[model samples]
Target: MAKKVSDIGGGRSQAVHRALKRAILDQALPPGSKLPEDSIGERLGVSRTLVREALVRLSQEGLVELRPNKGAVVSHPSLEEGRNLYLTRIALERLVVETLSGSLTQEQIDTLSTHIAAEEAARTEHAASIRLAGEFHTLLAQMTGNASLIRYVNELVARSSLILALYGRPHSSECAVSEHRELLDKLIAGKTDEAVALMTHHLDSITTRALLPRKDSLADALHAYAVAEGLA
Candidate 1:
């Protein structure tokens, strides 16, 4: 169970949605874990209607799978599906870099640096570090000021988290953090070609990492996620 919707003061359904979505992204709700409507509704102190709606939204984002009469479960992206996702992300992120390299405002740069700092701080925490790593890309897309691009990047990043949960090596975040720093340096220098190249390399490395075998059990994964979230 996660925090209650009443704690956040938004519409019950939206709050429940965010809580559940965060749980999924953090791997507290691991890939392929059952998400029973009654259990979730009870946990969040929301109605089954709200829980169902929240799950429907997550399914649309590729974060959850809705099976026939099976209710819902967190998505378990296959290696092939992960590859396709990485391919799409690489193309979209190339466009993001191309648009932002020579045009980023100091404010945007500062915000990005701040995000990197947060990533650095979370380095010892696996789930937090990985989620921030994905968010770094979403933040970049947001800087482009394109609503459609932002939406697509957000969805892809969410799915990417699931991919990593299913296949990434435990030490994957170390390389990702270093590459993010390098990519930021290139962007700040306005090296469009270099930035794009680094972005491609960064994404390729992620895809490679996601193809590795994951050895952690679901209980172990949830424990790590809970510790990272200060719930342990």
Candidate 2:
């Protein structure tokens, strides 16, 4: 029972993080927008204390930058940062697949298959598809039954999603859902090496295609956003 209450703040923290992160990811907040504590407090109907705590946690996770006198701003990850993040993901997730191999259960395989199906159904639901695509790694880690690995992979996936949100060229392409389908085929066939190799290649493609910020500014971004939202 004590554990339940103790879990509440963590749950609230995740809620706030998801809300703010999605706003940033969807370009609602944009990359350089500042997150004012009191305003978010009022918008989300939470306490400033909770908002502050959440922002600090995001800062620690490399999703937000807490500056002196500047408060917290959504992190504008450079191309270097994007490459580093994906590289870390490749290393960690490769290990996850290796560990999960030969140990994966029929039940886990069924669960993953269902997730892939949902991904297909969500293709037209851009936000749903994006979230499900990010979940592919998280789902795999959880199926491996390693709590620590799941936690690490979840965080990496979250940051990676943020990066895509900030810099991804307008859904001109989609997450290679077919690659996930093939990955499942390998796992079911116990072709662990194939799955690992495919994941490496997949992430490498993302790194290669990413665009650095160049000289974009926050004011320009805000103006564009306001125009899109009919505020300008």
Candidate 3:
């Protein structure tokens, strides 16, 4: 828990939000799991008000659903919903690659290469690799320098993580690293069509693995994330 309510009031709400978000993305808080305000507040040493605030923010980002009086739960996408999410992601990423093609600086290429190397190194750590894989797309969107695109990509990437956690089998992050490296090469080489095609194919492969089918203790779920966020 935080040392003071004032602390939570100031900026610790984002800490609470990050903890819950990380927990959800990593499947520590699986889809449809209850997120009671009091329990979260007590566990994180924040007030219910802060917890509610954090949850509201997550809800805005489509990671949490706020029921009228039942409080919040992780958003559980249906099979159809999940499919649509990935379809939309494919379109957005196509745009991302299009925007980035012929525009990638040597520095951006180096950054992406470094990120892929990190992904390769973290492949054995399932959760970290998954998070990094999703981040790779967001990094591309960030490079596009479109605020709206960045926001949408960030939200989609996060929800995609949640969806994969819910319905996906153990996938090969190694495959992702190789695909990302190839896609980057295409973009850096200014081959827009090939880059877009590869981007589509890469995202499609993940979608194929996901869109299939598919909980934990609330306090236990929140504990590790809260501690990581300096809330416990």
The candidate that wins on TM-score is: 1
Cα lDDT for residue 100, candidate 2? 75
lDDT of 1 by residue, 66-182 (tens): 999877989888877888899999999999999999788899889989999999998888788878998999999999999999999999998888787677777678878878888
Which wins on lDDT, candidate 1 or candidate 2? 1
Alpha-carbon lDDT, every model: 0.85, 0.76, 0.85
Q: Considering every candidate listed, which one attains the maximal lDDT?
A: 1
**Candidate 3 Cα outliers beyond 4 Å, as residue runs:** 8-11, 210-232
Task: Tell me the tens digit of each residue's lDDT in model 2 across 1-232.
Answer: 1121222457777787778877765667767789999888777877778789889878776778899997999888775677788988999889887887677788888888898988888777655566677788789988877888888888888777777766665541265578888887877777889989988987777764443444569886587579989999
Off by over 4 Å in 1: 1-11, 213-232
Query: Rank order by lDDT, top first?
Result: 1, 3, 2
Q: What is the TM-score of each candidate against the true structure?
A: 0.84, 0.77, 0.82
Tell me model 2's lDDT, rounded to 2 decimals: 0.76
Model 3 over residues 1-232: C-alpha lDDT tens digits?
Answer: 5444664255688889999998888778888999999899888888888899889989988899999978789999765666788899999999999999999988989899999999999888767788889889999999999999999999988887777776765655658889999999899889999999999988888865444532347886577679989999
lDDT (Cα, 0-100) at 222 in candidate 1: 87
